[model samples]
Target: MFRPGRLQTAPNVWKRALSNFESRITRHETSSDDKKDLILTILSSTATKREARNYLSKYPLLKENDIYQSHRRILDSDVVSQTSKHDKLINDLLLKHSARSEIQLPEPPQKPEIQLSDTLRVALIRIPTPRRLDPETLRGIALTLRKLVQLGVSPVLVLDGKHQIAAGESRLLTVNDFVHQCDTLIQALQTENLQARTVRGLFEQENFSLPELLVVPLLHGIIPIIFPTTVKKDSTEVVMTPFETLKCLVSNLCGFNEAYRRNNANDLLTVEKIIYLEDLGGIPSLERFQSSHVYINLLQEYDDIISELYIGHLDSSVRDVHVQNLTEMNQLLAIQPAATGLITTPAIATLRHGTRTTNPIIYNILTDRPTISSSLPVNLKKTPQLNTTVIRRGTPLTIHLSDDQPDGKGIDLLEFDRQKVIDLNKLTHLINDSFGKTLDLEHYLNRVNGNIAAIIIAGDYEGGAIVTWESAGGRRVPYLDKFAVLRKLQGIPGIADIVFKSLLLTYSDELLWRSRKNNPVNKWYFDRSTSDYCIPNTCWRLFFSGSRVRTLDDLKGYVDVCSKIEPSFV
Candidate 1:
């Protein structure tokens, strides 16, 4: 309920009140005595109307509107003038206070004196190839000289054309001269004071030559002028002759080759190395050069490096020396022509596990090979009889309920039997109809088991369901895709595996058996070992048990019975 507009107007009202008060104070200061008395008399009148009229008459120059108008004008004018005066007054007060204060003005900084020492002079004269002297070494010598001076070692210095001493002349000669002059004048004071040391004898030495000298010192005052290499002084670029560049290239290549050999035995030679060796004029082509080779032939001297070097000396030479292209050479090594006789084909394997047996049957189908292998060992009590009837390569294998038992019932009993065969496409449709509409066909197909006798998929059976299938026969197959799918389903909370398992069980039973009398003897049957066969009570628990099934050992015992049934008969 706060009004923003009223809050904003409050500042303007306060500003007007301040301006009016300022105007009134200014009028009180400037008004004549008679005008002031008349105004005061008017204000002291009893009636409000009479007071107003009397006040206006006394200030006759001001109209009824002029009083208010002039008040504002004068206030505004005073504000501008007072602001300027206030700033000036503040500045004057600061200057006056600063003058009275005892704080001293800081002295201007003096340039440092450049005084040379004996050690530095000796070091400079000893250095050979003075122009190529290292900057770091020169700086180090300078620092050593400074330290020696601080230790009170006075030395004489020589100079060039400048009046400034080139060497340590000031410390050794000037200071000593002043001390001697002072000693003569203040002999009485010296008797009771500490004696000043004389550097006269130290400066008189003439044999200052140092052994093994290569650099000559150029003295400028007491300062030593040092000539150092360009690299030490920020800039290092040099224009090299073709021969020099070739030499550097050869040296670098030799180092690289040695490093490569030490690290790896399979180091391949590159064109750059070949060019470097060629420029050294040591070898022609190490091997016979083939014309069809697309890689740059350093021996032929037709590559970019040689071309650029040639063009560099042309009428209009290239400015940038670093420009070089080796893309063609790189491409030659990177690419290869497709080879013939490389066969490509789609191949897949399917595996299925039965109760009791740890091993299962595996079937592989492809353009090159179509076969099935069973892990049931020859020495086992029973084995699955495989249908030897060969089908053409690439033909899809089919499995379904036998036609003798129509209506999709009794299908589970004949599952292991070869009484019926339906293609993968038909089984996919059956699963879709039996499960909820949310079941994805493509996902299910991709999750089909390829490994024999291994859990293919596992998850909550309801919203997030898992279906595990293994290939027939003991064949090694990749089951990661199936496992990934099952993991995805398991991530959904609250969904249990029993829902899907029960649905599959119901579908299998309905599809396998046509009627009660049609139940096959070796067919899968639900024996109520436990009281509750409902999903949550039995099937759910069994599916979610993962590898910890309590009835697994019992299930294995029934494998012999399942094996007795003929492969073709349900």
Candidate 2:
């Protein structure tokens, strides 16, 4: 085998070369990270880079862009640069090692902060076997994984062999051929310090509680790579679809049976994060500023997103993958609402694009939130983070109208009585906590009762929007009386975004809300609203959603009504 880096020698010669190189560098007193980087940087310029790409290139499903792939690929793109750097690094390290080495390695940055919460320590990552293994992308993924293990956030890999079946080659091969090839070649290779045990598939044998085989590897800091292959009744091993494999894991992880409930008797692993790696990247939606949906509140937006994928995009191939991804997420997430579902492409996962310096998966494990906020306007962003989506099950939304009446199948909010559907005590608690002010409950209810248009509540009043109709210029206009989220929940994930989404479902055409000019939440409100203006003589700033606030009369109608509304807070 050709030695990696500047040396094109046999194995024995390569070992000696590494020894001599390390010995020479040891005298320089450089950091371990710097030494490793200088060694890998020089070696990466060798013959093996092409071999790495060629080995995984057989699987056509991987189509990672050259730019987004590991940094090694960047070097490979230009032959002259690779060769020149290789020769120069060898010359400097060997010839100049004694004369105060001229090579200056960049100082290694500090280890990233990994904050593992209750379920953040472990992640069940579903990766389409790392094909098109550009050595650099592999390096980035491996480096990040090692750091996670060091920080106690161990990740288990579920290897999906979809391309083998999707490839036209499956038509010609026998089932035996498929099993042998899929079992052997689909393993995650070429990375340092991470071991992968390919479990032919998840099992439910009468004797085995799914313990012995899987636990040992993990205890030894190995990543257990579960293949999507299962043995059938007749003992013929058949490959399952990626989604089918994940479904079985979810059932066991959620502890469906006594077998699964046991500490180690589970048929599936206890999964905190069910991460899906697809070539299509994140879920898509025409409604978002960017084409990809950054965050999906599955309870409210799942069916609509699924419909969006199916109807508009002519390329059903990509659309079908997106649908399957969300469908799998929605189903698997059914058992564990606390569990998170992340969808992103391999390229996006490995690519450190724009201002992002860390791997997205590693970042997600630490934060439990997407790197980008869902409602952040596209234009305000300094860089584009359009690929990954942070998906979590949302609280079910229920809307109630006043007088228990409907306007032609639509629940009109014109007289929404909070006393009817919403628990008054809980609503009072929510409003008081959100505004940091004590509410005069009697005064608030009396003021909003008859003037209420609709009451929208998200999950036992975790978050809510109170809308009321007001009379101005002899016209009754919808005014956002208060938009209250539990102050504690204000810092939680996607609460405001979900509440606002629910509001639009009920009031599709127009709505108006206001906040004090100095409130920090004004930035959040400004991003979602259609227009805004400061009421000339007052501290309040009125904001409107929908196109109706364009003309002067519309502005007059907004200010005239918003200014007259009475505050129920002390």
Worst 10 residues of 2 by lDDT: 58-67
lDDT of candidate 2 over 1-570, digit per residue (tens): 544753545667879877855654442332234334423422332223433343123211112211123444322332121122123423433353435323332222222212222121347777765454465665555555554554345477766667766764553363454445334432323244345555543454321224333443443345656655666556555666677767766665455333434643322234667888777788876765436777888887788888777776538688777887888899888877877889887766663222335455655554456766675544333426577887999778776655455433323222233335457678778888888999887777667665677777888888887787776566766677777888656655677777776665456567788888999888778777776899988888998776343567777888987777777788
Q: In model 2, how large is the Cα lDDT of residue 423?
A: 70
Candidate 1 segments exceeding 4 Å error: 1-422, 436-438, 452-570
Listed in order, each prediction's TM-score against the native is 0.12, 0.69
lDDT of 2: 0.60
**Candidate 1 residue-wise lDDT, 365-467, digit = tens:** 1010112111112122332332121111111112122233444322232233234432333333333433323345444433332211212111211122222
Error of 2 at 32 (Å): 9.2
